[model samples]
Target: MSIRARLLSTIAGQLGNPHGTLGKGVAFMLNRSNHRAIAGAVEATGVTAGATVADIGFGGGAGLSLLLERVGANGSVHGFEISPDMLSRARSRFAGEIGTGRLQLAEGPMTGLPLADNALDAAITVNTMYFVPNLDAACTELVRIVRTGGSLVVGIGDPDAMAKMPFTAYGFTLRPVAEVIAALERAGCTVDHQQLANPPIPHHLLVARPA
Candidate 1:
């Protein structure tokens, strides 16, 4: 990793949590317009209370925490992150929820989540798809884990915006949102909603359902 990536990795490992830590940075990076657009798409899909949700590439755990709050005590949320450092912070931050068995954090990539097929009610990934080496495999894995009626929410900032960001100064290429949507559709996920917002940053929110 470059110096910048190493620094970000360190920071993410140290401060990220299940609440709003990493998300604050994400929100700031995306600016207000894109943030609202992504939020609107999520709300439209209806995560609902008591749903079994999984947040893939759950960076500081902000989205997962939000889902937790929405799902309430009767619901469950599972978070998956490949970064061991990030996973540690998330575990510490959500200790109470984990202890209560309402939230579970796994240290792994979304492509190989240790979950049963058709077990989740919903799942979401925000601005993390760019780092995935195999988008097709990742989408397949997502489809396998989500139930027939379950939803997959994906949000990605514009590649141009990301390239101009400090993180990309190190070495990160933004993934094409159009290609991602096409891949998801090829995997048999029905596209339920799609939205694009350009403000803080250009972003696209695509909500898909398992067929």
Candidate 2:
């Protein structure tokens, strides 16, 4: 493979499941760059005390702590991560919350979240949609898990901006904003908000609610 192709492949591989030292380093950088977007997604969920929420791609757990705070003593937050390195780091960081039964972390695929159907009050995912093997299936899965009238917040960098990145040429799917909103609507969600920003990196935040 050409050097460029090889680099893209390596990035895609690490994102799919970061595992070792390199993965750890990448996770750290991801956590930093993704912090604001993650917070925005979680805020869009409008999570509250006594609410049951889930973080679909809870990488490095940047938003986990904030989610836990919003959930308070009466609520619960579940984190589903595909990366082992991320899962381990999250589990370690939130051990106290986990012990208190306020936070639960697991290694699971987004297409088949390990939770009861219609079990969540809200769900959020930041910078994860690009890596999903099937966007439609992933949307169906998320819609199935979130209860009726529940919120689903998905945060992503602007496709136009992300496309400027090299990995997108390899495996990342630069889904159009319109296409994503349509897919969520098809999955029975009513798009409530669509926020966009361009600085540092372009960002898009979509907030939807199940019908």
Report, for every candidate in turn, its global Cα lDDT versus the true structure. Answer: 0.72, 0.85
Give lDDT for model 1.
0.72
Task: State every prediction's TM-score relative to the real structure.
Answer: 0.79, 0.94
On residues 1-211, what C-alpha lDDT tens digit does candidate 1 reach at each position? 7777798765443322322365456434433334454455456557888989887776655666677887899999999887665677678889999999999999777788999999898888776676676889988988889898778888777777777766454334467777888888987898754656564566677888888
Residue-level error in angstroms, candidate 2, position 27: 1.4
lDDT, residue 9, candidate 2: 90
Candidate 2 lDDT tens digits, 94-205: 8999999999888778898899889999999888888887888899899999999899998878988988987777778889988888888998999865665753487888
Cα lDDT over the full model 2: 0.85
**Top-TM-score structure, candidate number:** 2
